[model samples]
Structure formats: C-alpha cells, structure tokens
Target: MSDQPANLREQALEEAALWFASLQDEQVSEQERQAWQKWLAESVWHREAWAKVEQIDREFHQLPTQRSFQALQSAGRSRRQFLYGLAGAAVALPFAWHQRDILQAAWTPGTLHQTAVGERRQLALADGSQLWLNTNTLITVDERAARRQLFLLHGELYLQSAPETQALRINTDYGSVDMMNTELNIRLGNNSAHLAVTTGEARVQLAQDTTPVTVAKKESLAFNQTRSVLTEGISANDEAWRKGYLVAENMRLEDFLKALGRYHSQGWLKCSDAVANLRLIGHYPIADTRKVLDTLAQSLPVKVRHITPWFTLIEDNRNISHS
Candidate 1:
C-alpha cells in the first residue's frame, strides 16, 4: 500500500542479506563491517529489512542446530542459502518461528510422549488405557492417585480411557475436556480446539462459557475462547488419520490442502484463488503428499505446480487448458 515498489523493496532486502552473509565469514575485515554499519544506517528500509533478517537469525539460533539443519537438508538447502532466500523473498519470520516452536515443543523432554511431523505413535498407559498421537503432537501424561490428565501443547491425539474410578482430562489453551471410559480425538487449531467423541461421553468447559457443554457419542464440537461451541455429526472415518489416511468428504480445496500440509515436512501447500473453492471428495494417504497432489490433479480441474521443494501451488486447470 505504500509508495515503495516491490522490486525496490526486494533489492533492499537482498542488499541487507549480503551484509549479513559477509559478517558471518570469519575473515570479514574491519572496513567491511564498517561499510555494513554505514549502509544499515543510510536508509530506513535497509534498517527495517536488516532487522527482520536478524530476527529470523535469532529465532533460528534459538532452535536446535541439528534439527534446523535437517529441515533445511530435507528441502535440499543449507541454512545460509535458506536465510538469503528468506530475505530476498520476504518470507514471514513469524510463521517460521511458529514452526520452530512446534518442533521445539515436540522435542521437549518434559513431555511423556511426542511425535514428529508425519509420525504417529501408540502408547499403553499403566492403567490399561491407550493413546495415539498424530503428527507434530506434544502431550504430557500426569497420572495421579485421583485422576489422569494430559496437556496437549499442539497438534492432535486420540485417547481411549480405561475403566477407572478417576476421570480423564485433556487441557489446552482455550479450555479443558473431562472424560471417563471414553474414546475421543482432540485437535488444537490455531484459534480453536476440536473435540470429537467417538464413544461414550465427554464434557468441555470452555474458558469463555460459565457452563460446560456435554459432547455425546459420535458428536464433534469446535470451540474457541470467544465463540460458542459448534457441534456437528462425526462420521466413522473422522479418525482415519490414525490409520495414515485423510478422508475428505466434499471439502474445500484450500481446507484439504491445509490439512494435508500438516503431514508434509518438505514445504507448504498453497491453492490459488482460481481453485481454492473447488470441492474434493476422496481418501488421500497421509504418507505421500506428492502422490496425493498428483492424483488430485488427475481427478479435479486443477494443476499442481511445484515452485520449489518447499512450495507448491494448485491452480485452476481451465486456464491452462484454454491457454
């Protein structure tokens, strides 16, 4: 919205990136460091771009080096190359930080159990209950004399409680769900939490509501800190991700891609406006997202464009067909 041209802004970022790269070298001269400082002080845009680059570097430094290097390696890139690309392309630092935070939390030793991206794990509790963790999930189990509690830091998990005198509770930022002898799935979304009761019953106590809402068997509820609970029917295939497949029934292309992206470690999936609203119905394997995209392109009026190993775009095939 400002008067700055896109190309100019990109150029400024690139210039700032060069200075950063230069400073990283052990043989950098005093004159070069002075030049970089002078350039950084010359213009506001240059300073702003350098600040963002520094922020990205700071976040990366906070993460475990091996994990960060592995993520870059999977994308066929190095850390320096990725940082330069981020600067030139103006990648969102906050989003990168968020992903790092998820990975960091998953690696935290405090949690009794955790799962990495595209990895599902099963555990047998001491009380004969079972727990299944979905991709990028972090949960800590607390078994006290009175109750069994789980704190879901991120992602989704399916729980089957054993028959016990004490109740089971799952806690998140938005609220908590209390259950006993119940089979349920809990997913932590960006702004809300989803609780689906596959068997038995559970009660959700949202932070905003004074009274708790009871979720019956075969019912799904989504609630946030500010909104009332929205309930819907749960199909048998709702928990199919536990079996390594995502069952989509007339789901929007954008929504489907977002769900699929969670299992993919390479990069993000983006749908162009021309195809974002298109509906899809199918069971896609969570194991191989590239294959799923290829299959989707064959079935739907869309085309998959791989911009990079880390970025894919889905566009309407009608335009390509006409062209």
Candidate 2:
C-alpha cells in the first residue's frame, strides 16, 4: 500500500518532468503550451513537482553550456526521455547540491517582503513609516543614510510616511513617487502604476521625463513608462481597500469582479459578455468572497456557477433561460 502511493508520486513527477523538458523547445506549438497549462492547473501535486523540475533545470544552466547540454543528453537516451531515465536523478542531484547557496540568497530577508495571495500585511518601518501591503504584493525597502527608498515589484501598497528628516521615495518600473510626510495609495498594474494621494502631496517622475509633476491631496495620477497624467477629485472609495472593503459606484460588473478577484485565493471570477456591462453599486467585504458571489447572484440577473475550485463563471440568467 505504501509503495502504491510512492508509485503515484513518481508517476506525477515523471509526467511533470516531461512537460517541463518539452516546454523548453523553441518549436513548441501554442496547443502544446495550452495543454501543458491545463495539466499544470489540474492538480497541486503536479505544479509542485514541475516547480522542482524547473528549479533543477535552471541550476543546470550555471554550468558550461556545452557540458550542460551533454549532461542532459547523457541523462536520457533521447531528449524527450531525459527526466524519466535513471540518469535524470544523477544529473539533477549534483546541481541541486551546488545551487543551495543561490536558492538561499534569492530568499534573503530585507531584500524582499511579499504578501501571499488573498493576504494583507501591515509593517512599521524603522523610520516610523507605515506600509500596508495588499494581496500578492512584493516590495523592497532600502533605507540609506541620505535617503529612504521603496521598490514595488508588483501588486498594491498604501504608504503613510512618518514625519522624518530623511527624504522618502517609492519606485516602480514606470515611475517614482517622492514623499514628504505624505499618505498615498499606489497600485502597480500592467505597464503602469496608479497613484492617489490622500493627504499631503507627492511628486511623480516618469521614466521618460525628468520634470516631476506634483500631485496634491484628493488627486490621482496614472503613469506609464513614457508619460504621466494627473486627475483631480480622487474618489474616497479608492482607499476603501485599506479597510478591507471594495466600494464600487455604478461600476461595470466585469471591472468589479476583476477588482474583487484580487482578494480571492480560489478560482478566478469570470463574467460572460452578456452581463459584463451591467452596473453595480455596493460596498463588498473583501474577506468573504463566497458571500460576495452569493450577493451578486441575488442582486443581479446572473447565475454564478462554480465549475471548479479555481474557476467560477457568472452567466446571464435571462440568456441561460432562453437557451
């Protein structure tokens, strides 16, 4: 019985390893990529095994390119059978042992602070600043004798700078925000960063432009790699996420669900186009997503279906009936 469980684990690892190797090919088709993703999403065990295989392979790259290729070839009779063969274990073990230092350094403290999916965290900096991290956020704090800096690698953060003598700044790939005893909210999106000032003021300097634009209280700015645009009359509801609530005012259903999905750890919330434009106004708690979905079903002309733990679909009820 114990051997049966071991055999299952080995089978899963072998399959994951095959997928990992196949994906490395430059000639891999889109259909093959989709199938691989489906396999990865089907089970947690498969994901974990694939992650380990990827890590081992990455470590293999540190060796001489020609030697690494030879090693991989020798591990299996053919490239496709590389991970399943007996030599696979032999090839992977040495790289794993050699890369321990690299893996440990990657996760060193003070270099990175991250909030898990569906998790929030609050931190008090040494300079008395308050930092609140939203779901799936990663940030790094660098405090120097001359200046204090923060880099938002991804996700959102609300920062309240304490009254301090040092100059404080927050940086993203798009731009940087200079703060002086300021309270602000910044969310990093694809290719852009959204900045809203709650109190005091912030100066935003985009990557392409040298001149910093000043944003005052109740103001917001959206900047990409090339430019920054400032807007007045920032909504109070924008900061509602700090209090663990999502406040939407006649917001499109698709947009609302996308915002709500940030706080959810389970399946993605997907809405059909038939009801995507439906407007909703409400303050929903971010903590209880199941209840939020139930509320949506009650208030809107839509039916929520849980296809899987990782996929929830919202379809127009009227269309469903007609069909």
Q: Which stretches of candidate 1 lie over 4 Å from their true place?
A: 1-110, 235-237, 317-323
Supply candidate 2's per-residue lDDT for 28.
Answer: 59
Per-residue lDDT of model 2, residues 1-323, tens digit only: 22436556666666665465445555557778888888889887687678766665555556565555434322222222333432236356424533542354355323667775567899988878899998767787777535678888767899988885466888787988899989999988756889999999999989888888999999999999788889997775568877889998999998888788777665346676678899998899888888999999999999887643334667687644211
lDDT of 1 at 70: 40
lDDT value, residue 115 of candidate 1: 76
Pairs with steric clashes in candidate 2: 267-310
TM-score of each: 0.68, 0.66
Lowest-scoring 10 consecutive residues by lDDT in candidate 2?
73-82
User: How many pairs of residues collide in each model?
Assistant: 0, 1
